[model samples]
Target: MKRDIQSFLLYLFGFLLLWEWLRPVEQLTKTNHIEMFIIFILLSFAVTFLRLRWIWRTILKLWFILFSLNQFHYQDGFFQLGWLSSLFGELTNNFGMIFAQNWAGLTNVFRTLLFFILLWLMVYLVRYWLLNRKRIFIFFFMTLIYITVLDTFTLYSANVAIVRTVIEGFAVMGMLTYFRILAKENVTSDSLITRKWMRPLVLMIVFSVIVGIISPKFAPIWPDPVPFLKAAADKGGEDKAGTGVGKVGYGADDSQLGGPFIGDDSVVFQSEAVEKNYWKVETKDHYTGKGWIPSGSTLLRFGGDEVIPVFPIHSRVETRDESAALHHFMDYTHLIYPAGIQRVQFERSYDLEMDSTKEKIIILGFDSTPIAPDSYTVQFKVPKYKASDLRQTSVVDLEQINTDFIRKYTQLPENLPERIKELAETITAGETNWFDKAKAVERHFSSSVFTYDQTNVAVPGENDDYVDQFLFETKIGYCDNFSTSMAVLLRSIGIPTRWVKGYTGGEFLKYSDDERQRPIYEVTNNNAHSWVEVYFPNQGWVPFEPTKGFTNNVSVDFTNEDGTPAAAETTAPVTPVPKKDLEENSSKSKESDTSFTFNGIWLSIITFLDQHWKWILLSFVMAGGAVGIMYRIRGKWIPYLYLVQFRLKKKDENIGKAYLVLLGQLERYGLKRKEDQTLRNYARYIDTFFASREMSKLTDRYEQYLYHQKLPEGSWMESRELWENLIKKTIA
Candidate 1:
């Protein structure tokens, strides 16, 4: 009984160790209702522990899984089969996706089932190791590695988890080791001996865990590797190579483009604006194919009261004056201003520097060093464009206005692929004016053909043009890909376009105490994004969002059939803040609820798959390997199970069933029962190994049962004790 208690404790700790792995899934990834997975795991362990028949255990687990799924999708009726049709439809589509290697296309239900299967397999492995091998160190070690990796790379804080895992893991290993020793030495089970071994083992685990907890932890001697790995992957010119997508903040390098990046939720600044608007840091006129680079720069210094000249409002376009106050969370020297930015207001005397060619503004301190002010107010104009005015404005007007400006903004790398130009020309063949041509190219990237992805993005090779690869080959990437490709495609078609870098208007936190102005908005590193600004001599630079699932909210009036401007101008939808923040914000408001529901679920599935699909697939692979091992090592362990199972039997029918079990154990133990050998002959060969005649005695009655199909009434009691003795001796 004491041994049973200790073994249960060991299994309990193993379950706790596995629980540490699931704890971070919901908080760290986009996976929802992780509590369902937790409940499933607990049930799996419970069913296994009851030592029920395999068929019964499988049935219970299956029903519980269906119950959980019903809660998620069939809430209209308790445990309804309403989901079966949906399940079959999604399953067929997903099977096609798997065949095509489109892992991301898998639905949420498929991912959920895959995750449950993974947990089920893992729990089974833990049970096997604990009961058969009396060891769990491998799993414990793996749990440690898993926790540490997640804590380092993701937002999951494994500090408490690590502590709990360490205590649980060490305790499990110590107890399992004790069981292995007891079995190896053939020690007698006694209350005093069990207490003697267990107390010290418990104390050792407790002492080590306490020491580890209290030990002075030094600052991480090395920097975080996730950012380092990201920077290294983005080392070349995937814009702001040094500043690259390392931690998702604004980067300064635009020398190269392409590569994968992770999301960073760290806040960069907060702004109080009348409405959400795109904030620009700079524009790059030159595309090197790999990434953006600024062209020849001309500097202009001005005071707060001066009119800012970056993308000035043209005489043809209508505008309204608007101002925004920005309070930064980080010390960034560069200014992030909205379109038509006129000037900046500061409490202290300061100067603003503008690289007119790049349209980048910086705050200048007393020493002329670029310094970030804690707070500043920017005044800008918001243009309401007219269809008649913009559509009538042509490239002829732009070239006539400033050939130098046209030449500078329309620059593309000389080696840019010919196919890109062909594709761009094909996309915008019918559009005569720059605005229509730009719009034509913008509509080309639809969600049906392209996806907005951050981590799975590809880097352009030395011979590969970034825009060409994104447009023709991959068709999947984030803002950089969409914006750069748009800029390049427009330039290819002779429309002057420059790449613009900036932050999208951030999430709406809440209304301020006064609640008079717009809601408070907090922008994070994840908001760092890029878009295309097509230059029309009359309309200045107009921002366009070619990235699927995002909009720049550029207002444009369309012409009616009568050729007059439409009564009301159309404002594009709000910018979908690229990665994580948008998904989180959309879940709150009923106004946005319907619009964002699918996107929210899709983002969550993507996020979880992004970090963990490899593990889920691998769980099955490891499960296969475990099965092969179980098969090979069956002989070393199968007899003990038979010994335990038959020890409780009393039915007369158990005599024949128990005899067959004895034969199989003997065969597995290397005393193969020859086909020609009589039962008595096999029994005599078995008796030779352990100097026991009990097998012969059991076999004589076994022959009576095998031939007559019944045991002699009093002979059965004698045969049972002899059968138990011989089976034990064969294993011993």
Candidate 2:
């Protein structure tokens, strides 16, 4: 009965330990309670039925079997199961279809194994090494020390969790105490009395509980021991997928480009513009047959009020139709702007810089600062060129082109295959104009010759030219491949072209009336794109869309008359608001906010809860199920624990405990031993009333041991026999 009590309490305490460890696993994997429930049932039942050593062995064997089956599922063809041979092949083949695909599946399996191992090890230590009271105390002391060590590594914010674990630690101490008591020898009923050690043990446990509850919270002095455990929990609870921007990586550094691409639709910025436009971040002139590189020229710095000198060719372009009205706000580091940005307005003064070519703008701040603005408005003049006008311009002679621009844009590695040049020449054979030649090269790639595939895009190997590999071999890739191939082909025929990188105008958002019904575009990292910029004589540099299905609106002008610049289109100028007008608007907004109250916030919360009540109920059900399963498992361990704790660990105290048991048994049979009566006197009264000498003999031995302090040889054995004889008679 005593052993059963110990086992019951120990089993219940095991659940607490299991819960703490499982909480950590939640972060690492999406293990549902059903899976945990199955594991719990298996382990608890095994502990109840199997010996300490066999339990661990059985768990390990089961784990190996499951793991092997999982591996067989992932293996190729029939050969994976064939290795198991006739002896194991039948078993392996039976479950060959069940494979562990995600980390969560694997994590759940591993966590189950770990939980069982911990339980078995704890039982082994207490049953085997915890022999005497001193050893039991030492074992508990060591356990407390380990708990302290764990405290340093646990996430400091989970004080409640820490406290619960500490309480479990006390339960372990209780278990150890019981185990020690159960290990004592068989007792003679005559010498039964409560041990003096019981009071001190109870006091110690109470003191420990008080200390655990009242201890001051302190900051952890070292790194958390299970950092991944906490990280896994936080991520496991989230509904989002994959790491953000970092996964799609930016194009600021060209060396990082030209690899497999994944489109992420997560919006990065929202812009209100006159029309959807290709927002350029920077231009890359030097291509190393692998990736592009900047010219390494110093950037020119300017204040917010300064007019950035962007255009070197001012005379030929008509500015009236080119001005694009836009208002942009984004919390991102890169300053994304449309093809032509002439002026900007900001709420506060900020430092800015333009690259050496004065084509791209860079918002300036400390290196650590992410470039963002509360809000900003820009007026850009996009050069509109008609296809008729571009088609009419004849090809310029190589010597007539700007020497510096020609040298940079026409750069190609010496090892570039000659076939590339031959192909470009063959495609443009009939085109005399530079514009037509460029268009012909662009058309060849934009045709069915290539297909856009992000995952299969081939990266150039060592000693391999990227453009050569893409054009001749793979012929399947995304924007970078098509754009780079066209740029390289155009350069082969003396048409200066450079690679430009930035985001494409993303999906159009709803129209905004506050900004006068301008179309809003939301751009994301998935919108990161690369294209070619062709330098046309006298008309300045223009963009060309070589990528299939993607249009560069800035490069295509439908309004131009035949072979001539179109009539300029004008835009309304935006005027700044006066200080008094801003103040009036702020006051009016404050007045409008008066209707919302704390009660309104509560109503919104209540409405949300009402709608999500099913989910809330499901959560409660899972929690209840977990608790119920643990309790059900606890039921099996209770009986064995009574024997192990009260019988085995406390054999030295049994003489006293057995006598108490007999007294209680007698009292239930209507032969009560009064609290005031001495054991010898009670035995005499029992003998007189029942005419039993068996009780008299037991009483004499008790008096000899208690009054004379005698421990004669075989005296305890004699007492045991006499007490049993009297108890048998009393029952009759």
Candidate 3:
């Protein structure tokens, strides 16, 4: 009975592990995970009760494969049988073609098979440990290490479920060990030891559950620097490289610019500021026809004690000024700054360059090589732009332009099509002023002439101009395509412009009620954008919006001085803030409920104690009773325990202790010998009621031990062993 119970528990444990792998059962079945787990456990119990032969076990395993295939379509109810048959027929009919056509499906099938194989191996291992009880502790420790390693890499699950499963696994192993120990001994079952032994295991489970509930979720402070893991992360980061979730590649010579838009909503940073503003990461003057790259400059190194970088701006006033405190959740090397930043404050010092012309700050030498700051604050002056003011400004004169400045901003590929230049001229034909011309180009793109698309953007072929391809051929692309084309077209007409890359002003989240009481906004990769910055004669660089769905930070006034409303103009609406699915958020919260407040945890503990005080007190009383019973039995049991210990240590010197134990057993059953009886007479008397051959052997050995005066050196030891064996046989 004990062995059978142990076997059943082992099978249940294997099913539990298998269930973890099969999780998220709602995806596979309409049933909830808890219901599925219960059903699986019941199924395991039924399988164990079958007591199948080895061949039947193999057949059962084969049946499991069919059952799994069938269960995948089980949601169809009675129709699943027909669907399975059809699926099997399809597979058999076009085995080779199906393998070629559905390679991913085949891979999934193989992966499922491998998962089941691993589960079967775990069950086999448990069975082996149950039979070889001496090695069970070593296996238990190894299994624990294996499970811990698995939990480290895998996503966290419901804490209660995880803790419960882990504790149950250990408890099941301990129970098996106890049963195996009992099976090796011939003593009658004692409920006292069982009750005492279970108390600690139960207490362990209770404590573990409480700790799991109250533990904070684990997150690494810094990224893993291990080579293989880093490599894997780097590979995974490729798709997210240009996107906002991980890193935005500002230092790359040519950004890999085009791909299907995959949106990421993971908050990389949150900024507390007075109003929304563009957070610039970096800028590049040189466009390599493929992407942007920085013009190489000499390094400016700052010592460890140097001040943080700051850039001054003359165009934007310091009034209505504000500070942005950026809290980073992801590592970033390039510090993000808002436009018109006057001073920057961070924990560390770095060499800085203030480009007053571009209104940009460059970090040349950070005190620490890689600047992975958790948070920083920037004090910036917000731009106060009115369209009337921009309309009044004009372009810089040709002779006033320095040769280097003209060469840099007006630079274009020699192979650029004349049609692109003509297109720019045609678009701005009615506009004479440089500001109006820039506005015309911006308005032309922002209108329905070009469509905004992310997934349909084309990758230019070698020798093909990307701007030309976007303008004339596609007429539909994302922000990079629109911004690049606008910059290049404006430069072709002698209006100098530079392409800028950065994230959009993120959506306002909520207000923080700290000392500052500022608004917080979450910024992610999907907010990454590119736009054109047009350089005016004396006003320095000004930003323009060319994308269909974006509005740049340029403030526009449509009213005239006569107090009459200006004409209604159509403009792109602000981009919608990406929202998370409610179901998904709920599921995540349920799974990740690891964070526990002290008050909440203490309340739970108090509630649990209050509810279960009766059971707890009863357990304590039962434990005390078991201890008292053990004390009472010490006189009889202690000597037997000492004899067993002696036999274990000194194998050659039983000293008739085993025979005396056997005699005690028989005497308890009223088979005591008469005091005056001879050995032969005693044997004859026993033979009348029971078999006497075993009794005769016991008597001869006893006689030799007591009266043999001329015995050999080891004769008493040999007689003691023989007497012990015959006494056991007589008692049985």
Best by TM-score: 1
Better of 2 and 3 by lDDT: 3
lDDT of 1 at 140: 87
- Rank by TM-score (best first): 1, 2, 3
Clashing pairs in 1: 237-255, 237-256, 237-257, 238-256, 238-257, 239-253, 239-254, 239-256, 240-253, 240-254
lDDT of 3 by residue, 278-360 (tens): 77765566666766655655444444234334333444422357789999876665567876666667776655553433334
Per-residue lDDT tens digits for candidate 1, residues 1-732, read: 775676578668878988898898887567888888888888888877767899999998888776766677554565466677777788799999999999989887788777888999999999899888887888889999999998886657889888898888878887777788888888877889878988998888788888988999898744344533454232322244443344455777877767666566678788888788888988888877778777787899987567787767787788888888899878788888999888788888888889987888888998999887889889988998876667876556643567787778778878888998899888988777777788778888864688676555676776888888888899877888888888888888778888888888888887766647567788887788889888777677788988776777677768665876553444555655554654344234436534433333433454465567789789989999999999888876786787677767666768888888888877877889876788878878878877878888888877777889876566656677787677666656
Report model 2's TM-score to 2 decimal places: 0.46
TM-score list, all predictions:
0.50, 0.46, 0.44
* lDDT by residue for model 2 (1-732), tens: 554554555555555554554454443345444344435444544455344576575676555444534443334344455544542543343334235334343433344445545654554454444322314445445544544545554533444666676666565666565454544544322212223444566577678878877888697543223322222222111133311112242435555334443333445677777667777777878777776777666677777567656644334655443333334433444456666566666676677777865256766555524366656666677665655555655756556576777788788767779999999999999887877788788789767778665444555767778888888998977777888889999888777888887767766778877747877767665566778888876666777878765666753453545534443432222222221232245336546876543323333344355457799999999999998997665434443443344434323223344455556556655788876798878877888877877676765555555566655665555456565555555456
Q: Which runs of model 2 end up more than 4 angstroms from their true locations?
A: 1-246, 311-314, 318-330, 365-370, 387-400, 555-732
Candidate 3 or 1, higher TM-score: 1
lDDT of 1: 0.77
lDDT of prediction 2: 0.59
> Is 1 or 2 the stronger prediction by TM-score?
1
